[model samples]
Target: MTDLHEALRRGRARARYSQDDVGAALGVSRAMVSYWEAGSRAPNDRQLSALARLYGITPADLAEGRDVEPEEIDLAGMLLRADEEIDPGAAPGIREFVDFLQRYAELADLLGIPIRGLAQSPFVHRAKFVQKDDVRRKAEEVRSLVGLGTGPIRDLDPVCELLGITVYRAPLGADLRHAPSGAFLNHPEVGFSILVNLDMTPGRRRFTAAHELAHALFHSNETNRVVSNGRGPRESFADAFAGEFLMPSEGVRRFVEEVGIPPRIVDATDAIHIQRYFGVSWPTALVRLRQMKVVTADTYRELKHSVRPVSLARSLGYSIHPEEYEQDAGLWTIHRFPRPFLRMLRTAVIAELMSPPTAASFAGVAVPDIVQILGRPHGNAEQEQPQVDTEFVEFEATGVI
Candidate 1:
C-alpha cells in the first residue's frame, strides 16, 4: 500500500493537474508543490485542506492513502474528461461519480457478478441517423433483445441489470444542477455504466436510463463517452428511441383500444389513468396519445395545461414521486449504496474478509449499526478470566491497619 506522500502524488496525478497548476491554484511556487509531493517538505493544515479541495477528497482520504493511484486515473478512459464534451461546472460531480464506479467494480468483482455489457457492437450502424426511421427500428430491436414484447416495462432497474448495464442514482443538489441528467461511459473494467440523476421524476429517470442505453448501444462507437445532456441530432435520436421504447406505438394503439376511450380524451382523469397504468410520465403518455391520434393536438395541449400528475396522484391517494422510495426507513441508510451492494458488503464482513469498522466506514454508517445488521454482539465479548489490578494496594499491603 502507498503511504501518505505517495498518496499525495497519486492524488495530483489522478486529478491530472500539473505541479504548476496546483501551485498557481494555491498561490505558491511550483517548486514548493514539487517539494511537498517529493516528501522533502510537509504541508501545513491550511495547505493540506487546499490540496484536499483541489483533489475533491477529504483531507483524511489523502493522508490515509485512500486516493486512487495515478495509473488508475484513465484506466477506464473516462469520457467525462473529454475537452468541451461536458459542462465545466459538472466536471467535479462526474469525477466523484467515477470514483464511486471504481469502488463498485471492486465490490462486484468480490461478489463474483459477471461483468458484461453492450460494447461497441458490429450490429450498430456505422453512420448517424438520417431520420427517425432507423432510430425507431433500433428501439424496437433493443426492446426485443430485452424481451419487452411490445408491452410496458414494469421496472427499469431489472431491465438494465439484465442487459449488463449497471445503473446508479445520484442525489439532487446544487452541486449536480449543471450535471447531465444521465451520462453513459464504456468502462474498461465495468463495460458500460449509466448514471441517472435522482432529482428527476421517476418517469423522467426511466426515460433517462433508456436514453443513455441508446447511447451505449449506438453511440458507443461514436465516442468512448457520451453525455445525454441536451438536444442535438444524437440527442434527438435518443429521445425518439426513449419514447418508442417506453411507449411502443403498437402498444399504445392497442392500449387505447382496450380502454375503449373515445377518439378524444375529454377528462384529465382519463389521461392520468393512462399515465399511471403505463408507468410513464403524464407528458409521455399524452404525447403517445397524440402520436397514435387517439387525442387531437389541441386536446393534448389542453390536458397539458390542466393536468398536474403529482397533485392528481395525491388526490387519488397514490405515491406519485419516484424519489419517495429513498425516504423509506427499510432501505440502507447510505443513499449511494444500493441494496445489492450493501448485501455484498455484509457478506464480506460475515466471511471475515472485512472488519465491521471497515464495512461501516464504506457504508457511511456507525460500526454498531453494521454489527446489529449482521446479527452479531454489538459489544466485545467478556473475558473468560478477570485480571486483578496490581496498582490497587490492599490495606495490609499499605500497612494502613
Candidate 2:
C-alpha cells in the first residue's frame, strides 16, 4: 500500500472507527472507504478534510503519512484518544459529534451567522474546582444573569442556546448501557457545544444539559472537553449545579408552601408535586428535598423505593408527557438535532452555500427531501428569472424546512 493509504488505515484504526461508521458519517459507501484505504481511489478535498477530522489528524499529517504527535493534538483529538482508553465503543460517536459541531460552525460562518463565544456571557466563570456551596452560588448567579428568577426552568435548551451554547440530541450508541448522560466541548472553532444522549428521558436530558452547561460555564478552562458519567468531584459539582439551577432551594420551599405541605413531613404525594412542578425526575426531586432537609432520611428512602413516578403522576390527575419520562422517546425523531442548527443548515442549502447532499447529511434527511424542501438551486438568479417557492420560504420559518 502507498504511504498515504497506510496512513489512512492507521488513522482509522487509531480512532477505532469501522469502515461502516466512516462511510455513514461521510455520506459515502463502505466500499469507497475500502478503495481509499487500498490506494485504488482517492477522496476529493472535502472528503479528505472530513476524513482527517474524523480520524483526529490534520490533513497535512495524513498527506505526509505521519502520526499526529502529542504536541500537535487538538482538543477533539485529545478527547478521542482519551475515550479510546476509557470507553472504546463511545469513541466513534464522540468523534462524529465533534465533526458535527465543526461542520455546524463552518456552515454558520459561511452563512455569516455570528458564532457566540463563552466570554460573551457575563456569568462565565473559570474555576477549576468548585465546592458545593460555590456551585450553588454560581447556579444562582447564572439564573439571575439569565433573568430566570428561581422559576422552574420550563425548558433548558433555549436557555443554553441563548447563552450561545449549541445543544444536540443524538444516540451515543445502544451498546453504551452505562453511557454518559452527556458531554461538553469547548473549541476555538465550535465555541461551546453539548451532546446529550437521545436514549435518555426528557427530564434526564434536561438535567444533562444543565450539567454540561456547568462544564461549559465553569470547568471549560480546566479542560477543553468533558464527558460526564456522573462520578468524581467535578461530576458531583455539575450535578449540584444542575439541581440548583433547575430547582433552587428557595423555589423548593415556596413550592412546598404553595402545596400546603409541612417541610419536615413531605410525603410521596408532595414529592410528586415537586417533581412535576420543577420538571425533574422523581429521584431528583426526592434528593433535593432531602438535601434541603424538607424530607427526613427515613421519608426520603421510603418515597424513593415506593414511588412509580409516571403511574403516580397519571393517578394524581397530572398529565404526563411520555417523552418527558420515557427513555429513547427523542431517539430517531424529527427533533434529533437542535432546531437552530437545522435552521442554519436549511439556510445554507437555500443560499447555495452548501450542496444538497451535504446539507441532507447534516440534517439527517435524504438529498431529495432537502431539494423538495428548499427547491432546486439556480446557479445565477440574476441571469435567469428566479422561480420563487413561497412554500419553501414558509416552511423555513416554521422549522426544519
Candidate 3:
C-alpha cells in the first residue's frame, strides 16, 4: 500500500503535472489529488484509468505498485526522465506525440493490425562508441535488411515503416539552444516509433529520420528513447550511419564513375549531382565524397565554399520544391502523422470503431473536417442503396423478356 502511494506520487512528479493540473484533467479537486498522493485517499477505478492515461501508464501499474520499466512506459515518461537533456518548451510536442502514438495504437488494434516490433540487428548489442568501419558495416547491414542495395533511399519514412517502425512528423517549435532535430522511442505498447521535426527542410527531415532509424536499430536496447541534437559520440555514430546508409561508398563511386568525372577533378557540380541523386543535403554529399576519396582534400575545400545548393540545383535544372524529394511538401496535415497512420484512422472511422471527434483529435483536425473526410460509416453507404418495387417490375420484364 505504501509502495502504491509512492508510485502514484512518483508518477505524477515524473510527469511534471501539478496537483491542480491532475485534478483538472481528471475532473477532481486539488485536495482530492493531494489526498490520493498522500495515501489518505484513493482514486476510484474511473479516476485511476484517467490518471494512468494522463501519466502514460497502465492502471495496473499504479494499482499493483509495479516498477515501470522505461520500455514499458510511453514517450511522456521517457521525456520526463530525460528532462535535463531536453528543453521545457519541447514538452507540448512530446505530449502531442505521445497522444498520437496512443491513438495510433488504438486504431491499429481496432483494425486488427498490431504494431510490429523493431527488427533485430546485430548493432543493437554493439558498443555505443563504435568505429567508423563498424558504423559503415551496420549501415550496410540495415540497407540489406530493408532490401536496398547501396542505392539512394528516395523515401526513408516508408522504409522505416516497412521495417515495423512508425514514423511521425511534428513541429517541435524553435528552441535553437536545446532543440532536438528528431527523436526515437521503443516502447512495449507502441512498438518502435520515430518523430522527426517538421520544422526542418525536406532533405534535413529525411536525414533526421535516417538518424533516428539508426538509434532505433542500434541504441534502442541501451536507451529506450533517444533525442538527436547532432552532438556527442552517439549522435556522431548515428550521423555516420545516416551518411553511409543513404549514400554507400560503392554507390557514390558508381555515381561518380557514371558522371564520367575523375576523382581529382570532382567539383561542386558533381557534388550537386551526388546530392540530388542521393536525395541528401549538399554538405552530406560533400562529406561523403571527401571520406570516399572521390574528391581531393583541396577540391573538397573548394566545393565547401562553392555556391548554395538550392541555387546550384536550380541552375542545374533540378527542382528545389519540397515535393521533389519526398511527399511531405506540406506540414499542415493533422499533427503531421504519417500517411499510413492517417489511412488507419480513416479505416477506423469507417469501421465505426472510432468516433469522428476522437479521430479528429487524433488527426489534429477539426471534427467537421474529419466528419467531412470520413463521410458516413461503412454500412451507411449500403443502407443508402436505391430500392425498386419488385411487384411492379422485374428484371426479366424490364429486360423485355
Model 2 regions lying over 4 Å from their true place: 1-75, 82-85, 119-129, 173-178, 329-332, 349-358, 367-401
Per-residue lDDT of candidate 2, residues 260-350 (tens digit): 9776865677778788888887777778888878889898888878878889889999987756554654244545566677777778877
Clashing pairs in 3: none
lDDT of 3 at 40: 91
Model 1 C-alpha lDDT per residue in residues 207-267, reported as the tens digit of each score = 8888888787777665556766665778777777888888887777677679885656877
**Which digits, one per residue and each the tens of the lDDT, describe model 3 over residues 1-401?**
33777878888766545576577667788899899888898888898887787676788887887778422345575654443567666677777777888877777777998667563434554575888788888988888887999888888867877788888877775554687887887654567788887766666777888889888888765556677877788888888888899899878878768878665555677778888999888777788778777778888887788667788899999888765455463435653677677778888888887788887866778776676456544435555444434534676677855
Q: Which candidate is the best by lDDT?
A: 3
Answer with 1 or 2, whichever has the higher TM-score: 2
Q: Please give the lDDT score for candidate 2.
A: 0.73
The TM-score values for the models, in the order shown, are 0.66, 0.69, 0.70
Q: What order do candidates take by TM-score, descending?
A: 3, 2, 1
What TM-score, to 2 decimals, does candidate 2 have?
0.69
Quote model 1's TM-score: 0.66
Candidate 3 ranges with C-alpha deviation above 4 Å: 1-74, 119-123, 175-177, 296-298, 322-330, 354-358, 367-401
Span of ten consecutive residues with least summed lDDT in model 2: 69-78
> Which of 1 and 2 is ahead in lDDT?
2
Residue pairs with backbone atoms closer than 3 Å in model 2 (clashes): none
